[model samples]
Target chain A: MKESFSQSMDWLHTWAGLLFGWLLFAIFFTGTLSVFDQEITRWMQPELHRVTPAPLDLDAASRTLNQLAPHADRWVITLPYDRKPVGAIGWQHDGLSTLKAIDSRTGTVIPRRETRGGDFFFRFHYQLLLDQPGIWIVGVSAMAMLAVLVTGIVIHHRIFKDFFTFRPSASFHRSWLDAHNVTGVLVFPFHVMITFTGLVIFWAIYMPAGIQTRYEGDMNAFWAEAELFFEREPANQPAPLVSLADLEREARNHWKDGQTRSIVVEHPGDRHALVHMYRRSDDRLSLDSGRVTFDGAGGALRAVWLNENPAYLTQSVLTGLHFVRFGGSPMRWLYFGMGLAASAMIATGLVLWVVKRQGRHAGADAVGYRLVEGLNVAAVAGLLVATATFFWANRLLLPDLEARDLWELRIFFAAWSLCLGHALLHEFLRDGASLKIWTTQLVLAALLFGLLPILNAFTTESHLFVTLPQGQWHLAAVDLTTLMGGLVLGWTAWRLHHPVRTSARSCHTQPVSSSSGSIGSS
Target chain B: MSLAAFLLSYGGLFALCLAMPKHYRAMCGANALPPRPVLLMTRIAGWLILGLSFVASVDAVGWAFGPVQWVGYLAMSGLVLVFGLPYSPRLVLLLGILAFLAVPLTIILI
Candidate 1:
C-alpha cells in the first residue's frame, strides 16, 4: 500500500515478465513462423515443391476417395492453393477415417512424409503440442502478457520522448533496456492487438461462462449459433451424389469468382447428403468467407450462409486479425517482422533482468540469480537450437519411417533438453559465467540454420539453387530466411564474444539498481 | 500502391523523428533544437504525409484492410528509423528521402 502505483506496476512487470517471458517468447516466435506455415510445409514436403499449376482434378480425386472408402459416410476434399499446390482427400468408413495427399495435377496419391509440417509450429504456438492443459497454460501466459504490456507502458513514463530512441552504444544493461523499450513502443499497437486477439480467438475456452449458461455447456450448440452452422441426420436411403466440380463451380459463381478452399460431401450415399463449399479467406480481412451448402444428391442450392450479424462479424474479424490470413505475402512479411520484434522485446527484457543484477551478483551467485540465468540461456538460446533441430530432423529422418513426425518432435525436445542440461552443468561447474553456454548453443543454432539450405540441397532437389530460378518463392523463402537467421545468430554470438567496454562505475550507474529488485525499494 | 503507402509511411516517420529535438540533433549534428517555425513545419508535414499514407493504403486495398495495413507500415517504418538511427543515421535519412521520392515515381508508373 505504501508503494506508488508506478513502483507497484514495475514490480508486477518485472516478476510477471520473468515468470512468463520464456513461454511468451516461444509463443510469439512460433506464431511469427506460423505466418509462413504453408510455405514451410511446402519446403518440408519435397513431393510438392515441383508441383505444376493445374486445375483441380476433382473427378479423379473423388474417384480415388470412392475407391478408398466406398461406404464412407462423408467425403472431403481440400483444393490446392498458391502456397501449397497439393490436394488432400479424406473419407470416413465405419468408425475410421482415412486421409491422403494427392497430386492435384496428376490425381494420384503421393506418399508424402508423415510430418506435422508447419502445423507443428502453429499448434505449438497456441497449445505447446499438448491438449487442453497446454491451451489453459497458453491462456494464462496470454493474460500475463496483457498484464506485462500494461505495466510496461505504465512504468516507462517517457513514452513519447523516447519514441525514436535506441542507444546501442550504451552499456549492456542500458542497451538492453533501450532495445526492449524501442521494440515495445515502436510496434505497441501490434503488440496490444495481437495479444488481445490471441485471447479473443480462444475466448470461449478461456471464459466459458457464456456457453455454460446459455448453451448448457454444449460447445456444438454455441458454435452452431455463433458460426451459423447447421447439420442434419443422414437419411439411410441410398442416393447418387452430385459432381464436386459442378458444386464448386456453382459456389464460385455464387461468390463472384471467389476461390473454393474446401468441399465436404456429408452423408455422401444418403438421400439427405449435403455438400458444403468454403470460400477462401485470401481476399477478405475476416476469416469467415461464407459457406454455400447444396443438396448433395441433386446438387440443388440449400443454404448460403454469409455472416452478417455484427457480433459474429466482429468475432470473425478479430480471429482473422489473429490468424493473419489476409493481405497476401507482403502482409505476412509485415506480421513476421513485427512478431520477431515482439520476441526480441521479450528477449531483451529477460536479458535485462539478469544484466541489471550482474553487478551486485558478480560473485554472490545467489540461487535465484543462477536459476534465472540458466533458464534464460535454455529458454532463449536453447529454444533456437531446438527449432533448428526440428528442421534438421525433418530432413535426416528416414522418409518411410513409421510415425516420423513424432520422431521430429522428440528430436526437438531432446535437443532442447540437452541445451538445458548443458546450461545447468555450466551453472554447477563454472559459477557466475554463462558465456560459454550462450556462445556454444548460439553457434550450434547458427550452424544448423545456416547449413539448412545445404542440408536441403543434399536431402532434396528443391533447394535454393533449384527453387530460386524456377520462381518457386514459397520454397525459396524458407531457405533464404533460415540463412538470414543463422547470420543474425552468428552476429549476436560475435557481439557477445567482443562485448562493449564495461566498468564498475557504469554498472553502478545503471537505472535499474539492485534495490529495484526488492519490491520495497521505492 | 501498397509500395507507395509503405514508402510514404517510412518518410512520414522519418519526418516525425526529425521533428524531435534530440533526433534532429542526432541527424543534423546540431547541439540545439531547430527554430520554432522549422519544428512546426516538420511536425505538420510528418503527420500530413502519414495521413496521405493512410489514403494510399486505402486506395491500394480497401476500407476493411487499408487501416490495418497503414498501422503495420507505420510500425515497420518506425522500427527501421529507430534501429537505424544509432548506427547509420545518414543512410536512414537517405532511405527516408528515397521513400518520398519513390512514392511519386510509383504514382508515375501507375
Candidate 2:
C-alpha cells in the first residue's frame, strides 16, 4: 500500500509538472524580469536619460499640465525617486487617459519613444497578453505548480540525504535530475514563498467569495467600504482650485515621514475637487503606507488613512514580499538572482521530463518523443530568444514609427512564433536534434544580448561605461547584466556543443536504474 | 558587509557538505570517507559559523528588514554553492576557504 502511494505520487508529480511546464516557464521567466521593470523602462526610453533628480516643483508641473491637458478631469503627478529619476505626469480627458515622462527639474514633458518596456513582461506574466481569462489561466498553472512541488517532495524520499548532491558527471538523466533537484532545493523556501504569495496577490480576483458574500456581488461597494477612511464622493460643484504646492506642504506637515510619492487631483476644474498626497513606502516593507487628502478649493485637511489595521498590514506585507518594491539595489539584485535560480529549476525539470522519456522509448515512439523535444526546446530556449529579440526591437525600430509600441509587441510575438516554427521545422527535418537546436538558439541569444550594450552606446549617449562613472547605477546595471547574460549563454552554448568526455561516456554506458524508470513509467 | 556575511555562511555550509561521506570522497578523490569524528566536528562548526553570519546580517540591516535580507542571503549562498560544486569542486573549495578567511577582514574593514 505504501509503495502504491509513492507510485501514484510519482505519476502525479510527473504529469502535473509536464502539462503546465511551458506556461509555468513563461510566467517564471517574465516574472523574474519584472523585478527590474522600472530600470528596463528607463533604459528603453532614452529621451528620459538626460533627466536628473531634483525637487519636484508642483507649480511648474501644474503649469505644464495646464498647457498640455487643461480640460482634463483628473491629473496625477508621480515624483521622481531614487530608482527612477524622472517625474511622470498622467491625466484623463474625455474618459481617455494618457501618461508621459516629465523632466523633474523643468517639469517639461520629455518626448520619449512609445514602448511597453518592462511592463510588457509584467503584464504578460499575469495576463498572458489576453484579458481577464489569461489571469485565470496563470492562476491555474500556479496551482498546478503547487501540486507538483508537494507531490515531488513526497516521491523524492531522500530530500535531505541528497540535498547537496549534483552529479553533472553522472548519466544524462541523472545529471538533469541533479540539476533540477539542486536548484529546487537550494531555493526551496523562495519558490514556496513566491508561489504562495503570488496567489495571494490576486486573491480578490481568484476567490471573490469573501467580497461576494459580504457586499452581495458589488465590488465597488466592497472597495468603498474597505477604504472607507479615504473614501470621497464628488460634489460636482464649480469653484476655483487652490495651488497643489500648498496642499503638499500641509500633507508634509501631517505625515511623520514627509516624503511624497505622488500627487493626485480629481475634478481639477470643479468645486468638489480633491487633492491626495501619498507618502513614499520605498524605504519600508509595505505596499500602502498612508495618504493625506485635502479639499482642493479650500485646501483644508479632509481625511488621513495610515493603514494601521492588522488585516490591512498583513496584506500589505504579503504584497510587498511579492513585489520587492521596498528594497534598494542590493535587495533587488538578490531577488533577481533568486528568481533566475527558480527559473533555471523549472527549465531543468521540464528538460528532465523529456530526457527521461526519451531513454525509455525507442524508434517507433521517436516521432512523438521528437515533438515533445521540439516543444521543450522552443519553450525553454525559444522564449529566451524571443526576449532577446524584444530588446533588439526596442533598439532597432524607429522611434517615430506609427503605433510604435504596438509594433514592438508585434515584433516580440512574431519573433517568438518564428522560434516555434523553427523548432518544429528542425524536429521534422532532423528528427528533433535537440542539441543542435539548443546550441543554435543559445548562440543566437548570446549574440543578441552581447550586442545590446554596444547597441545602447551607439543608439544613445549613455551606455555602461559612461553611466557607471556618472553614478547612473540603474542604467549601468542593466547593461552589465545583459553583458553577463550574453557571456553565460555563450559559455553554455560552447559547453553543450562540446560536453566533457567523462560525463558523455557515463551517460551512454550507465544502466537504466529502477528509480529512474519509475520517474517515467509510473 | 552583507556580501561578506553571505560568503561566510555559504563557506561554512560548503565545509560541512564537504565533510559528508559522499561529498568528501568526491572532493578529496579518495576511496574511503572521512572518519565520523571529523564529520561531527565540521557539522558543529558549520552551524556556529552560520549563526554568526545571521548576526552579521542582522547588524547590517535593521531588525525589521534584517530577517528578510538574511533569507535572500541564504538563497544566494545556496545558489553559489550549488553551481560551483558540479563544475569545479576544487575551485569551489578554494573559493569557500577564501571567503571564510575574508570574513575577519570584512569585519575589521566595516
For each candidate, what's the DockQ? 0.54, 0.50
lDDT of each: 0.84, 0.80
The regions of model 1 sitting more than 4 angstroms off are A1-3, A71-74, A92-98, A234-239, A362-365, A501-522, B30-33
Model 1: colliding residue pairs: none
Best by lDDT: 1
Model 2, span B7-94: residue lDDT tens:
7679777877876776666566646666799889988888888887788778887765677777788878776776666666677778
Q: Model 1, range A142-258, lDDT digits (tens) per residue?
A: 999999999999888777767787765465656778889989988889999999999998898999998899999999997677665767998889987778778888888867668
C-alpha lDDT of candidate 1 relative to the true structure: 0.84
Residues B26-89, candidate 1: write the lDDT tens digits.
Answer: 7776466779799989999999999999999999999988988988998898888988887777
lDDT per residue as tens, model 2, A289-362 = 87888887888888887778788778887878888887687888888888888888888988887877765666
